[model samples]
Target: MIETKQTMMNLPGPKAKAIVERDQRVLAPCAGRVYPLVIDHAQGCEVWDVDGNRFLDLAAGIAVLAAGHSHPRLVAAMQAQVTRFTHFAGTDFYSESMVQVAEALVASMPATHEWQIFLTNSGTEAVELCLKLARHATGRQNIIGFFGAFHGRSYGSLSVTASKPLQREGYFPLLPGTTHSFYPTCHRCPINLSYPDCQIACIDLIERVLFQTTTPARDVAAIIVEPIQGEGGYIVPPPGAMQRLRDICDRHGILLILDEVQSGIGRTGKMWAFEHEQIVPDIVASAKGLGGGMPIGAVLARAELTRPWRPGAHGSTYSGNGMACAAALATLDLVQESLMANAAQMGPRLMDGLHALQHRYPQIGFVRGRGLMIGVELIEPETGAPARALANAVMQAAFQRGLLILTCGVSSIRFCPPLIITAAEIDEALHLFEQSLQACL
Candidate 1:
């Protein structure tokens, strides 16, 4: 857990150029990509590439590092857990850290009734697990997802993910009975009509599909959604939409599942992004920030909802890995220490800059989100067509200028900085963003 200090120049010669060797000579191209200067180590909110170029990590490893890289508390927790046991004696035997984390997780959420949690290894796993829970609990088959959503890459989760066609291009015959409904993005309406004029047609579309189409609402096991769609341009569906879905789920005996995988744990300046509406979903899935960059995922459900899944109904080898639990526990404490407050203060500053950018450049279609989770829709100003080229170019330029960013949705530049980011950091990052936007333009 010690901070690493390997750099480019000092890299061993031909004998062993370990720092740059990962991508230069070895590894699969499809494993994803990074900048030319390979990173050797990082601390707090900074990452030093092999070339010794330090960059502010606005993307935070795609919103994974909640407490910042190699946090002291998290490192200590990992060290302590490693000493006790690097790997658990057996997956069945419960770890002390796991129990404590489970308790803390369930209690942290807002709900008048009892709840329970099941830990896993990744966000996709939690999401897939929730889907299974829906079917198992309701004894039904159908599952409804929304448009412009990015669930995960797994077979089940990806089946419902509708962000990019390439994600499903080669993989044919995805999970069946999974339907996609349009969500009222409000800013870039799919129906081409303005807000009040159209009255949130996206949500209405879901209702229409249920009533007029063959997909019977009663047969639907669950209605799954991200309180604020993360990968699909960090889109936050208009207010009252979520509450309406909750009511729909109740009326049809369908489970309401909220995937907070990326928007949970204060990323939205709230315990959970759905908290903005003060509504409690039947089940919630979370990961990413939950473990403070350590690998961990979980699904929380009302205590009664977990009843159908009896003993041995479901589980995983690393359901509650000791080290992951320790890291998650330490993360919870660290987030409370100061990261949450930072997110609350800095979220608005970043948003203000982004909104201003939209005003300056009509190409910046719409800006929307909660807390640090923000997204800027890139569009052809006149026609409102998605401008993926601009978004991608912006990300590339941002990386070149010692800042990192990501793109999503049809054509949206997204931002999800570590919760520990400071006001000064926000100002500097925004300055870089302005430069990146210029490059994109």
Candidate 2:
């Protein structure tokens, strides 16, 4: 495994503690601070805390660093672009980098049909734009989202998000005409039904119950979903689930929107998680790893659907900022070159190790994911209930052991290390994780 100082230092060292003290005074309360990890710098999958403590970053800034931290290519591209010019009002004016970024995004999409892109500053913006476009194109008012799905935090995107009650608490009366349906989670089925044998009834209910009783299919503009639910837990829907959704959308003329914010950019082996189902989405929302840590989001939609919008219909000042575009181009190049394939190759290695750990640790109720975007759900051994506190404790314990991990859903530990992570690093992470588990126990 990767070598490191064998002894673990006292966490939140003097320097980190001081920074935390200052941050607590100035930073907003909403800024969720999980562990006291004051980062000084990072390279690849390794991070150095402010007090010189080292850490293996399995979270990757919530899976935004597809090319790892401070990748030379990304740094070079950003430096070169900033020196040339950073922002030129991309929506009002033209920039070659902006055009090239859009071109690259279109080319990366499925070749079955022509595609177009609308660049934004984050995945939330992309989702907001996608929702707007869906309504505009279909002349419909209603949208369908899955339960336990997170689209974004913006007013429009947040309307469809239901990952946590806390996220939507106090901010009520989200965008009108938005309804939530049950996501096909086989591990703990919402309807208490088995998979395959259940015939994917969760999706069918949208038509049989939802459309007929509440939001009519004729008025529903779109059905937005995450191929692999991220915050709701790294829950991967069973096979044929996506195809069933696609078929429903086709029959009802509802647009299919895939929120690839976390699962896109080769995190799930494929360039986009929806590809795993061999189905195409009308619009795809991407961000997170797209810019290799730089802030950039995009809405890739069928060309014909976006034609209704006039010149000044929808736009953003930083829609295609030169620096962001350059970073995106460089990041996409790295992902396409080998990182994508590397994720596909290394994913099995990591998952196999996790499975072995599950066999030994009964608390690991379920392990599911694709590529490097994996999650291990912790449950009580006797009751089989979600061990939410145990997951949090394990995450904190891992941090103390020089490993950075995060919890998602109710009791799942998400592992989304940078795509550039090596086999040795995975082993090291697993070892640290098991140690943390034992300590927590």
Candidate 3:
């Protein structure tokens, strides 16, 4: 195993502290920083702070660096594209890079359906476009979303995002005709029932409750969801949950939109998490790792659904820019060639390690996830209640111990390392994570 040695005993070392202080004075206060990690540079799964402190990066810029930081292939692609051209307003003009990227995205979709693509600059934009298309295509106003899902922060996306109150606190009176229902969180069943035995009642609630009382199924445009809830605790819905939703959408003629922003691009072993369920969605919103760090997003939909969108229906200046498309093509190439398989292989090793640690730590209430996108829920040892404070403390402790991690949901720490992470890196991260847990206790 590659040993991680920390050169600095104290965190926020001199240079990092100065830069952070400068940032606070000029930068906006809306950004919620979990810890004071001022990255100077990074490669693979390793990072260096401004103060020369070395750390293992498990967060991967919130799981954006699929091929790891500054991969030669991505850098070269971007550099070459910059020399030829950067942006020519993709909405109005055509570019080979843009066409190629769109083709690549369509190719990644299930073979059962032919897909069309609309590019954007971020996941929020992709979701926003999906919302508009769903309503336009179906001529319906009402939409359905699940609780504990973090789609994005834009108006339409935020309206369906029920993950955190802070995200929707003051942005109320959001997009009209949107409602939320329970997500099948088996760990803490929202309906106070068990999985497999519960028969996935949460999904049925949409038809039985929401459709009957508030929004009629005929008036609903789409049902947006994450294959694996990202910010909402990496909660993986049990088997048949997805198929049930598919059935409901098909019966009601409502579109099924999968927000693969954080769960796509091979983060979950499969190219797209929805593929695991063997049901093709009407639309898929992809970003995060799509560009390997460059800003890019795409709304992929069945060709029939998008055929109604006329010219000037929607557009963005930077969407499908040559530079972003080039970077994305490189990222897709890297993922298909090797990084994707690496995620599948390393995920088991990391999961096994965390499960073993759970045996030693009573605070670990649950461990769940697919491939490299995993979560470890920390709870109160005596009462078995969610320990939010302990979760935050452990995250901070991990950072101080030269391991970069972040917490999501109420009491879970998420591990979304780069897809290029190796066996030694996984073992080292597990070691640092155990030490962080010990220190927190």
Candidate 4:
């Protein structure tokens, strides 16, 4: 049995310091970096920095590696494909691996809907594809998105992204016909109303106010949403929220687009997060974990909606490259085999542990998530105000204690470990997290 070494040498050791200095000088200033630890290698749910320091990784590269880092199966598949062929401009040409991946993804859908796929290179591209298709198919210009939701950084997606003002501060004159509405965040209700009595006022506001006064439903092309909001916090809406959106779309002829970049691909212990709500979206944007560690994204839509997008309507050079397809095929196989089931079994266990910590520490204002995608919100112990500083301190302290975690939303620590994380690893992470919280206090 392989036992993990839960300790690290002083962070930014000699080797890491050299690299960090060089990176700061050369890399773009737009990249948001959390910590200074430089990774040298990783396996399963653990990572080591350049100084031979080992730490338990719970971030999973921002929830990208569902199969974990350096999995033999994925590495072997990618290596084999590299030797055979690398890129062939999949948009214009064809490759067996690319076709096979599309077929597998179609089969992984929730139900039998005549679906077609358009491959891209990242989640943002997937969102861009869906945005363009919605406008093209519906022949409408307006789009609606949630206030605390993040789709991507591209022009069309960024226009709908309202998670942080910083992401859109400098960029001006975004896509013209985009508007934002409140999401059903039950923990901190956006409309200042309770769930059972509120009757989903957020969804109602779209039709009652926004449609009637500003953006008419007739001109709206689509409503893009995240099944579980990612960067805005791992916030899951109350039940029936999605159904209500689907009903609204049905009445308005608006395409319901689900941006599952962070919540899909077995991260929620299911093939797709929307399946939990039992709602079939008109289009689903996927990425992050789709290619294990490799970069890949795709847009899945019903045949009717996609039919309008004729050939050459949209194309990219690296759309479904051979290497990415190979890695994705191996990732899908592993996710289907046993990793997904393991995530299903382990999710509640992790949440329960987090709940216990919350009980012990009142500073932990809330705990919520589905499957491996979890969040613990931090607040001031006395006033219950959002403690953004406290959250950052806990994250840094956790790193010192050989734990790798991250912060999301305004003041929440998001725990998105690799889906292959073991039970023991989960327990260790919780223990380290609690210790960090105590240190911060």
Candidate 5:
């Protein structure tokens, strides 16, 4: 059965329930809620829960599995690496795997001679490392971040992430000198100005904050952006929004940091999502799909950006283990081939299907984003305030129907299927999505 509730309850999913119960009782409450299906094993888009019920996973582990789960390439590469050494003292002894991965990254980066690389384990660590690079490069302290953007959950990245209050709750006295400005959300803009015609009020606000306002350019270390704000409803900035930010950063001598942790490595139909814009960031944070399904993060920058960072600037044990590097190298090859092409082709199909659905349902206020990184925004038909409740209902319904989807922003549902998804799979996911939205309505 491809996702029936009866099948959902039949397999090891029930036995896994015991593990969840024990985890909740003994483990930390901060673990948060999870959908009932327990993933037993997966291949392609189909994952069988403990109950032996198969479901289509559209979420793809929060955009980490762009090449799909347990692909033969990744398996073969990782299996080969398993016989080799895994970790080494990264700072003390450099591994050939990380060195080779860095070489590949530099080759993929924009035609620039200054692409230096640093390896980390996760997206959060990548951003954390990004901050250090900017600080060490510019000798500045303050940081300017866009509202509703999610960088990561660590202290440095979390402080910049202007999402829910709980994400920042109890983590008070966050990285100081960080300021939030209006995000370039074309739909339901905070500034209430029309896009393209308004000349991007969000970008204008950044100018106001830095040059005209109290945020002196001298103290600012870097300007961080998501290119396509992943968690912030997949909001795409206006045509010139990115270049404007680039100009502002250049005028002020501030480093431009792109958090491609979720958007990079072919997730957005490009090797780097920022390539859509002609501008180049001083430092880029990348993770998620960089290591295939395994965890790996990296800070890609110009050679000059890391000049000030000394030998011990940053160090981590698993920065680029043999397995992670092998998997990442294999992933890079896999994505640079067919998966990216599929994402470019399939993302628009899904978006068009969603837009058609939005025409039928007023609850879907707006839809925006690029490539496979798409979001359907929820809005109250009358008041126009964020329809968080509606978003939750749609997400829950989609999960129940065996299509794994995720929610984001104050009122939005994000769709980041694996780049390897086929046209038929995208259509099928949209079919389930339409049913979920109807039920939600």
Candidate 6:
């Protein structure tokens, strides 16, 4: 049985309030705070604020802690590595940990092709690496991205990110030779087309329209896409959409880059979300859960694709820190052994409960996801328009009820708990979320 704790006192109790007050003065205003609660410590699937209020963590540090906070195995590995040596700058120096991690990551790839790995310090950097390799390998300039995607905040990745206009506000001129197309969606079709009948007109638009008009296919280096739209609501593409994209890329001789930064690493009950489609990408960017909370990212590509870039082409001072690699190795071991299976088993249970909630409350217009990466879209019901304000209210209410959830897309709440979460914990979280929804309604 799982023990659950819901805060009884007013939130931000003294100590948390003081810290938030200090933070407001010191931190950048751009750093958005979902709630006023200040984290004191976290373990497994629960976190406690400075005021000793315990809350169930459904966000998992924005889907980073796949092994859960401070797992004994991960802590031991990181501790052991730290004692031996902390930093040796794998860019110039030799480190066994880096090689081991690279091997482990490559082993997780689909068995269809021979692959290699380049490690980075964050998801954004991994994306930047993919952008550089794609452009270099093809010697082409133009790259295509979907309408609703969040690659990263870096200049190169930002060019492909179109999740929200706020992220791009005043940030131009973005990288040249970048264009956008609508991602295939069944829930909210961008082009007002239905599935099967529409026959993924979005993909056809890429070839027939985008290629013919603004950007020529000959100059296109790659098409960067997220297997499942992350920040643009957890929108999953219709069946065969990926395979169709692969065929188009093949025909055009354009590289396909899968940015699995948020949807990868067992979050979707698979090592990589792209496995669901059984398609092989020319380059893949991964981060969020790769290091199990430690800062690490990686770009995996075929040997021929990356071979063109010689040494000293791109390197970071903290590309492959010894401790981060140790953490990553431990994370991979746990994911392969049990966490991925756990996600597969618990995902259906969580979704069923959410679906039930949808029946009870029509405000939950839609619920869709794979594994722990679920999204519940809120709508006004009468007009069938996005209830963005209501979504924010529900998220805040959930926090007040000792449940930590985040909002995404236009008016959707994302439930991305750690993969280690059990059935009992899922039930508890569902109960709390239901209560919060009721209160907000």
The candidate that achieves the highest lDDT relative to the unseen native structure: 2
- Per-residue alpha-carbon lDDT of candidate 2 for residues 174-194, written as tens digits (9 for 90 to 100): 999999999999989999999
Model 3 ranges off by over 4 Å = 6-8
From the highest lDDT down, the ranking of the candidates is: 2, 3, 6, 4, 5, 1
Cα lDDT over the full model 2: 0.94
Considering only N, C-alpha and C atoms within 3 Å, which residue pairs clash in candidate 5? 11-50, 11-51, 12-50, 12-51, 13-50, 114-302, 114-303
- Global CA lDDT computed for model 4: 0.91
**Candidate-wise lDDT, in order:** 0.82, 0.94, 0.93, 0.91, 0.84, 0.92
lDDT of 6: 0.92
- Model 3 per-residue lDDT at 243: 93
Put down candidate 5 lDDT per residue, 1-441, tens digits, no spaces.
Answer: 223332222323566677677767787787566466667899888787766666778888899997899999999989988988776766678788889889989988988556989888899999998887788888899898988889989899998999778889888999988888887877776778887778886787777755568787778889999898888778888788889999988888999999998888987788888899988888999999998788888999989877767777678888877788988999998898888888888889999999998898888888887889998889999987789988988877777777788898878889888888887788778888888788777
Task: Report lDDT (Cα) of residue 281, candidate 5.
Answer: 86
Which runs in model 4 stand beyond 4 Å of their true positions? Answer: 1-9
Indicate the worst ten consecutive residues by lDDT in candidate 1. Answer: 2-11
Residue pairs with backbone overlap in model 6: none
For candidate 1, the TM-score is 0.92
> How well does each candidate superpose onto the true structure, as a TM-score?
0.92, 0.99, 0.99, 0.98, 0.95, 0.98
Task: Give one digit per residue, the lDDT tens place, for model 1 in 93-131.
Answer: 867788888898887877687989999889999999999
